[model samples]
Target: MTEGMGDKTEGAERILCDEGLRVAVGGLGDRVVVDVRDGTANRFWTDTSNLEKALHGEAVRIDAHGGYCVIEVREGTGRLDLVMEGVEHKHCDFSTGDLADAIAMVREQSDPEGSLVERA
Candidate 1:
């Protein structure tokens, strides 16, 4: 779990699997694992360390049903071997400021806008 995780109620914990993949622990229950992406069923573990280097503000591919949701690591325990979320592209250098702002922007963009469709 990420640092200072257990302090918050109904909060998320940074979880690093033994295989080395990182995922935010949204919540835990019997036969139910909540992550940054809602309602994930297919879970996999890999020994790949590529995701461990992932840091706050870095993006990741959250595997779910049918498709995947691209998200950023909002927080993590800064460690060399810490397993973190895996994503496609990473440009920011794990800076705190960049991470925070980028995540905020992402959340804003994720909000639903009804049946409204965008053209071009």
Candidate 2:
């Protein structure tokens, strides 16, 4: 092995997204997981440390989905913000058993259909 060379991974990480939309969470640690085909306008502002890191440090961040909607959870923030950029943004205090809502969101967005979804 050459000096300063990292071991190359033969294949990218494969994710079993819900629905029919397949996606992967590359090098970024649960930071920006977007629909590659639909992420042309994607961008985000997150703390240097990622979600897990933020949680560990008790910090929060604001991010948009589809580069359009804002569906996110942050540390020390007792609210959920849903924003449809250039259209609307909503915010409300966290709700009961919200862990369910979160899981449901993941399932719907991950692979709402039954088909082959590739990693980008």
**Winning candidate number (TM-score):** 2
Question: Candidate 2 on 66-87: residue-level lDDT in tens?
Answer: 3332233455443333334463
Off by over 4 Å in 2: 1-24, 28-41, 45-48, 57-59, 62-84, 90-120
The global Cα lDDT (0 to 1) of model 1 is 0.29
lDDT of 1 by residue, 1-120 (tens): 111112121323344231233334322221112133222222322111213223433444433333333334555432222222453322222334433332333233321423222111
In model 1, the Cα lDDT at residue 102 comes to 29
TM-score of model number 2: 0.26
Worst 10 residues of 2 by lDDT: 1-10
Give all candidate RMSDs, comma-separated: 14.9, 12.2
> Which segments of candidate 1 are over 4 A away from where they belong?
1-40, 44-47, 62-65, 75-120
Per-residue error (Å), model 1, residue 116:
44
Q: How displaced is residue 71 in candidate 1, in Å?
A: 4.4
Give the Å error, residue 40, model 1.
Answer: 5.9
lDDT of each: 0.29, 0.31
Q: Weakest 10 consecutive residues, lDDT, candidate 1?
A: 1-10
